[model samples]
Target chain A: MSSPVTTKPFETTGPGKQVLEITDLKVSFPGLFKTVQAVRSIDLNIGVGEIHGLVGESGSGKSITAMSCLGLLPDSAVVEGSVKVTGHEINGTPEKQLARLRGGGAAMIFQNPMKALNPFFSVGQQMFDVIRCHRDLSKNEIRAEAEKALQAVQLPDPHLALKKYPHQMSGGQLQRVVIAMALACRPRLLIADEPTTALDVTVQAQIITLLRALARDHDLAILFITHDLGVVASLCDRVSVMYAGEVVESGSVGDLFANPSHPYTRKLMSTVPKLGLGEQSLDFIPGQVPDMSSPPAGCAFNPRCDMATDACLQPANKVLVVSKDTDVSGKHWAACHHVTGKKPSSETALSETLEEHNA
Target chain B: MSHLDQPADLLVVNKLHKTFTTKNGVMTAIDNLSFDVKAGETVALVGESGCGKSTVATCLLGLQSSDSGEIVVEGRNLLADSKAQGKSLGRDLGIVFQNPYASLNPKMKIKAIIAEPLKTAFRLRGVELQQRIIELLAHVGLGEEHMDRYPHEFSGGQRQRIAIARALAMESKLLILDEPTAALDVSVQAQVLQLLKQLQSENGLSYLFISHDLATVEFLAQRVLVMYLGRIVEAGTVAQVFKSPRHPYTRTLLDSVPSIDPARRDELKTLGGEIPSPLNRPVGCHFAPRCPRASDRCHKDVPQEITEQGHRFSCHHPINAAEE
Candidate 1:
């Protein structure tokens, strides 16, 4: 994230505002023989305080997009493209400036707390370090601030929990502690990479609720990266469905669920298990994510899409942005060859949703 | 023999107990856990991350032994065996771990990884060995084309297929899937699970499927075992267990997985406090501490398994809300 500098452009403000804007965001890695492109010419706009879900299977370039925003990629990584957060250009900034941007612009909570946290340090000390690094405060002030953050996440007996090491806390508690650390900085934009995947379903709900409430209370933007459709359905305001290093679909939660445009997105929604839904039934897309070292031309989702046309075999059928309600509604956007007039993955999906709403 | 009176069990876990001695004290990980898995049944050990599910699986596969118990797999006692007899036990007990790439050797060829277990179980070393590897690969939804490729050549789901193939290479009666689908994508999870179901049905192999997710449990398991603090609080057919969950912990866990359709509101029961540390497992009913209906008796007396209508529960107060 270290190139030369540019001048400050504008001040970011207002409700439903764009907190993050990424233009041609590309990240690549130097493989043994050649370079591997992890992300390619991606553009995304995350609305203010709304959870923008980034959904995809592993190696779909979801994590890299988040990491690149904070300049946390490895030595082999070559990041190109612009990542602007809070009206501050990030892609080519100095490491020191990038570090400053990190807890200031957006905070991140990782997938595995056990690995993300230092095992040697206590929960309190880790929180203290993060808090003190971001803010200029006294020792007592830092301790009090950290405890308050912990309490907000509903960690019981914050003082005692603070004294305990990361290893001492349960997986669920450690995750809450991690959440507290992220919230401690009060970042304008939050990037969470599968934080709740390691926790149980009940614990997962608690964490999601904490995140949702925190978003509402603090008026911060969240980019929740996960593969679980059930989670995205309930938590995210808008979702971007990625496949093979490219986002095939992006739309409002209800619009996307009601009418999933991308074949991959449609396939993903069908896989979520529902109550009294069906047995001896499964909606599946054939094939897997292509080897990123050399991805296929045209649509990345074309290989597995059952409704894929020959046009999908071409190079330029990316995402088709659509308005749900009105002109300039900007409510929904989908990346797919076909926008309408085709049966989606499961026949009963829409009706079932309606039935649920009616009941 | 009637179903209730039948003495024959494909996998009989009797008084399985495992304790890890730390500097602080002895932690009772799996406390006198006992269950039975009939032939061709998928018994899901459903719980959060550290509720001794893996411990029980390791014991059954002979990778780890219980402190005091007997694991009878296909009529052979896994824990009772002497050193010489145990070698035969590992052959019949196959395991599929969480990460396929972690279990498999990236350096070795796919054929070699699948054949390594076969060499121990069947001693096949000639052209027969190569043929067996192809057959195993095909069983796991992978083609013969995947034979020459390395572990890194495959996707997460494909790697899992390779691991499943290797597990099946032993031709074992029991296949332990410890979060096999947890590491894969949800869409890919359905495919792998469907393939697993097909293999299990055609081969008549039993699965001791362990996972933290209850949704996956409902999908794959015929019989569900709800574990908490190293104890089985509830165990029954998936319908009997899920439709009428007797244990509060089981119900709470089910409510936790956010429903895909937002309109459906099965009020989630989030257990208020953190799951009590496994290191200091409650002496009586392990769930009593977090249980909403915890009584004085629940804190003092161990809950006995209530065997009624082909169901079993270890809760002191197993309420029948449906009847109400």
Candidate 2:
């Protein structure tokens, strides 16, 4: 509690020095019955020392997009995209090279810590194996580095924890161990998928603080995947809101929270209850994410969006139209045919109604 | 602090105590717990993972016997003779667990599942039973078409609605809902909560809502009982407790919740260490180890519940005491 952990202020990364970049990423599972289009064409870029968030409900393709970066999708998946980590292409690489690049180049932490860690091996044994795979260090050197990683995450009794099995540790302690293992190789890019969803509120806060510090001190680029927008606001600098396999909106966290444009983003933000606010029924979006196999034509969110027009039934493409009277960077945009290319001055009626309440 | 002057309503539990002798030693799961639910009110039991909230529910439903308690329902002691001999009290109390997949029987049709309680309790058979099942389905926002569907066929929200319909089959006055919406997504959770509210108003049914989600508790419950370890640490109306939480543990929990607005993000002072093992609990206040304002008195003597302006809290140093 006394450690001096200061998070760097959030600022947009300058162009031309991206640490992780994805372009036109599309993943589909062709089955005998029907084809499940998991992820449509999408793009993303994260600079070094930045924490970028991918947030959506279940079956929103956020997890699959992250999996594509690691080339971990199953063989049945038809992936067509370019995934570059530290300026090296990861997709279409052979299994041997991908295995080598996985830990040393990039690492991923999953949701369930107990299931992620092997039950048979001690924590130290599994951690040493990862270190040995990435670096050629002596036994003493490896143990020292592992202890350092454990201590960096603020776990108590680092040496004793190494001797215990995964089942012997608490949920919070096990998560710290998983984080330590992920950081053992010092991978440049880290993909954490709902790492704190299974933890208690207090433990989640601690882990969030740790992640922020890691991004600052290690200069590591992170792709944080979660369904909770509250955690995204507190942790991420920039965010991408996905709905039914498409990025409906992408912008800085402040801009998105203040003036959300997409109907799904606005409705999703309203679902989260404020802590000090009085008792009020939450406003929830109607219906669920459509079945991936037979998605509707035109916009995927057109069926559920309240602002859908007659033109919304036709196909729409991505665009980066500039909004009026807002501090939105040119990259901050939404994929809606209704809002595209229309300045706020002319479309004041629709913009005013959609302005509503961001919360 | 005294309910002696008021008339008892639907459910009243007094001095409930439960303990287990495990490999570690004697562990007190419920320590002198007491609460009352009116005819049409929602009383929420808020706590973390293992705070004996579920144990209290089980005891009330007669699924598990308490070590010693006086559970009275509608002017009759549920722990006493005659009618209690055959567990007929179950007709008055119904409970829904966290996981619908486990609580529901997968082999049976939705019709048979909802009719199971009615068949055993009232012996309504044949056409009458079928009509009643369909009526229950409609009451919970489902339709007659879902009557033949199995538990696995419906979505999570639809399954929970079916579970609610089953709980209301016997015209039970009090329903115990344990984390009913925890497993569902946020938007779907709102839908279920709205349905619960609608049902409560229509049937005038009382609910003993148990959940760890504070926002849902604030929306649904008229009163809240905050539990730490195995004891009630705070009890008050939603406005009283949520606006100005008195206990240190309650304050910590509220602060730990992440806010969606970055400007409202307070400096988070997370509690160190996990909840102490129930078997090897610390002396005096169970929350003393984690409470930042805990004094030597908190570690030595259990603080008695203090009441002011209908707000009751157990703490050595309650917040906003000077203002009061």
Query: Which 10-residue span in candidate 2 chain B carries the lowest summed lDDT?
Result: B1-10
In model 2, how well does chain A match by TM-score?
0.90
Q: What DockQ results for candidate 1?
A: 0.45
Clashes of 1: 1
In candidate 1, chain A reaches a TM of 0.87
Off by over 4 Å in 2: A1-17, A319-326, A340-359, B1-8, B80-90, B104-171, B321-324
Candidate 1: segments with Cα more than 4 A from true spot: A1-16, A30-33, A315-329, A341-359, B1-8, B83-85, B105-107, B141-158, B264-269
Question: DockQ of every model listed?
Answer: 0.45, 0.40
Q: How well docked is model 2, in DockQ terms?
A: 0.40
As a whole number from 0 to 100, the lDDT of residue A319 in candidate 2 is 43
- A78-191 per-residue lDDT for model 2 (tens digits): 998888887788878999989988988889999889999999999999999999999999999999989999999999999999999998887888999999999999998999
> In CAPRI terms, where does candidate 1 land?
acceptable
Interface RMSD, per-candidate values to 1 decimal: 10.4, 5.5
**Candidate 1 chain A minimal-lDDT segment of 10 residues:** A1-10
